[model samples]
Target: MEALLKAVVAGAALHSPLATLVQNDGTEVVLEPPANKGWVLYTVQSGDTLIGIAGRYRVDPKAIMYSSGLEGIKLKPGQQLRIPLTAGRSDREPRVPPGVEPYTVRSRDTLKGIAARFGVSELELITANPWIPSLDRLTEGAVLHIPTGQKGLLVRLSKGQTLLDLSGRFGVSLLKLAKVNGIDNPAEVAEGDLILIPGILARTTYDNLLAKREAERQARLEAERKAREEAARLAEQRRREEAARREAEAKRQARLAAQRQAQAQTQARRQAAQPATVRRSNFVSEGGYTYPVKSYVITTYFGRRGAYQRYHTGVDFAAPHGTPIYAARSGQVQVAGWSTWGYGYHVVIDHGGGVDTLYGHMSRFVVSAGEWVERGQLIGYVGSTGWSTGPHLHFEVRVGGSPRNPLAYLP
Candidate 1:
């Protein structure tokens, strides 16, 4: 375990910037300088090895080893290793700073192809164009501003609908295409989708670029305003519908409450009219007669003691005029007529048992003397007439021709 740990530590130390380490057995390990020195930087490309890279940059393998601190000629994708320039070549070409221009996409382009064409690495292209999600899914005919001094070819996919066909035409992997567009499935893309192509190109000098950007901003604002108005209109319509529904429900409830109140009032009147157990005997009598009107309180009795020395033969019932009167029993009207003396309008009913009932001082009589009337039939209306004081019904019960006490037969 100790030996393994020591080997790992020694391997890490070789990559650090320090003097070379030599063992007692004469095993030599070379140390490199820091990569921050002023040297030309090159990014690794696809199919790039240390030998090919060293050959392309015109540097010795041992010199690269001394500068990069690599134990062997191994190169990985996107690795940034410095290229030591010849002393006189320093003033040959100026290096461009990062983020200088936009990129333009072209037909049948790939990151590897673009990097190879522009003498730059795929990693440098990716870094320069951060707006692009991935380099592998660049769309054809889409323009990107290329940084001025960067070296790389911008590869773009075709603008047509067939992504699979476009990928085939461009010689780019389908997986890379999906990665660039953030599409989990490559089959989901249709035609005419815009994709970013990674490349370095000469910057354009178009003067209307700022105006075009402003126009796009204005268009976006107008769209948002229209959307908000439409949403508000729909919300107002919904509120009006809700209010109408509530009003209809309230009206229905009010109608139901009115019906329920009417029913309760009817029930109370019925219950009040029922005879209590204690008052039942008071309403009954041994005689067969019932009162002509309900609650027929006597205002005047049969006999009268007055200054004129007269006698009153009938009982006067204090009641509202036009109150319904029933036949004393099943009977026929004997004499129904109007008179000016004592009775103004009167109705006489004769029962078969030689008993007769007289209703006098009536406003009108509904039955004539020849009319065959039944018990409880309304025969006349009460009134104050023919020497009467106020509205009252004059009632008289006679047996065989003589007036009798009405209370003797009333129930």
Candidate 2:
């Protein structure tokens, strides 16, 4: 019965897809145990990493990771993991579609460098394997798909830079960069986002970025130079306009001086042409007024004059001390007193019709108040008294107490 049982077990092994042998003692020996029937369902326990759980099942970490589309070793407690039927059976490759190559990430290898080495675009690699969360998580010992058909390199975007800027720097077109990154609006790309540069070297990209910065710097300097030149031009224009204004003012003053001299000469001629034999009026008349002093030398004229601070308001006759001052017309003496405001000993005479005459800077009065005097009569003497700067007769002709130009009434 033992021999028969041994022969029966060996015959079963021939069809069992397993090896069975009978030793000399007629004991049945199985060469390899059969693989686990179907898949093994494992409940995640505390302190379990993906690698640890895969080790317990004698499977690759990714084998468990790919089942749930997991990226890293993060595994939750109480989670169920489905172990493949052929997980530990000589560790085989996963199923991949046609025209794709399998690659294992190694130490110090970057996703950009790997894509460049294999002449594959970083976007194509990511699309082939959609399990990776980001390019930053492409750690060592991770498996990836490399697309050998299309060739390009991968790179991450930097700060303060745009896709157009990179296109100029890396000698790439904007449309090409946008198409590879699947960007609809180039300005909407986020910083640190991954992109692909087709058929370019790493060293060449670095050199291009440097050259672009230098070109921008030169453009800024040129703009500043033009601004300074424009400011200088405006300043020169203002200076020319100011110079022209000053020259015009000087010419106007010259013309006024000439006109004043001509007026003075014409007045002197008319005064010298007067009839010297005409008899003086005994009573005040509307016209025919005479000079208060015999001398025609005038120290100051009526109206505004350069020597006085304000309008002179009267004429001034310079004479020696005690020179007799006569009245210009017949009138009654209204005042005879000393004044402090440059009008020494002054006298006022009212000649009816709102007309009056004032004699200032006098030495002494010969006529008293309310006394009637005729034209050319002795009224006072010229001397430096009160606020006088010199011995002169300050004569004024007034209408209603306000001074008028004495020359308008003088012969």
Candidate 3:
């Protein structure tokens, strides 16, 4: 009868076009049933609990425990649990499709502000439209072609730096800088004065002006050589013709000097038109947190694993077992405990404003649950515990009970 039951289950799994049940370690297995089945199997990882795992997956903890058959509701890494796939909908908007309308620069516009408004990065904006100058100078009426399918505007306030300093730093010409900013004179800019910097325009204008200046300089040098030859010929003629020819040679030399001065002025004007580029502070409010360890890579990610039939639920940072873990932000510890389900030792910190963080699979805990810890304070050590395949720390950030992407919060 037992053999028949097993065979029946296997047959049901194979024949059911909507779902497939795979055998797990007697206690846990994934059921990849059809979408209509409405429930899927999730694998538990180190440091996962029925409540925490349920919260991460957006299901009721008690419901998962009961449905998965928990005599004691104990979870083990690689343990599979039944989960309903149709749970919650993420609120993030769909990304804009590529190749949309180009935006022209309006008066008083900054790349940073534009990027923030469009929900895109400043780097993306600059790369999309290469014609805009990279500097903070935007001309009053200069036209800019915006790239298709970009979003966001995160404008930064202009730092009170001189045009000369900015020019050298960003490699833009003074005149191009002035043209972008609509400044008649570069010297008029005062400290604390705000200005819109155009990055692509500065680069293009500077390169073109430098090339033109070099060409003009070469032409002038060639002209001067010919003029010198002509003057020499005139001197020789005057010497042969005696005192009467001296006046004519003097007039020729005077004309050559005036022409050289005019050429010099024209070159100076061209140089003055280009502008400078600069790197402004993108931080408008408080700066974001920095990484605790100098060098650590993510070996595992937060989610469900195939082997356990449950959700993993935390980001895994690979490091030495005893590598110190620091508080990502100033927060009070909430939970610190040991378990068999995968996380051997773990700590959860509650940072105010609905932000809670979890650190799992620790070799040691420096602070007890409920203790206030400052940002960068040593909180725990990394370890290979529970269901971890190797030595690493599983980290998670939770808003209420739902898991969110950690990279979005970190710098």
Query: Which pairs clash in model 2?
Result: none
Top-TM-score candidate index: 2
Off by over 4 Å in 1: 1-284
Q: Judge candidate 2 against the unseen true structure and give its global Cα lDDT, from 0 to 1.
A: 0.68
Worst 10 residues of 1 by lDDT: 198-207
In order of TM-score, best first, we have 2, 1, 3
Order the numbered candidates by lDDT, best leading: 2, 1, 3
Candidate 3, residues 204-272: lDDT per residue as tens digits?
Answer: 454554465577789999999999999999999878787556777888888877776575455435533
Span of 10 residues, lowest total lDDT, candidate 3: 276-285
Which candidate tops lDDT?
A: 2
Q: What is the C-alpha RMSD of each candidate to the true structure, in Å?
A: 22.5, 20.5, 54.6
TM-score per prediction, in order, is 0.30, 0.35, 0.29
- Per residue, candidate 1 scores C-alpha lDDT tens digits across 285-395 of 456566677654465566643433356677767667777666766688899887756888888889867889888888888998878887667887788767676787888
Per-residue error (Å), model 3, residue 403: 1.1
Candidates' C-alpha lDDT: 0.61, 0.68, 0.59
Worst 10 residues of 2 by lDDT: 87-96
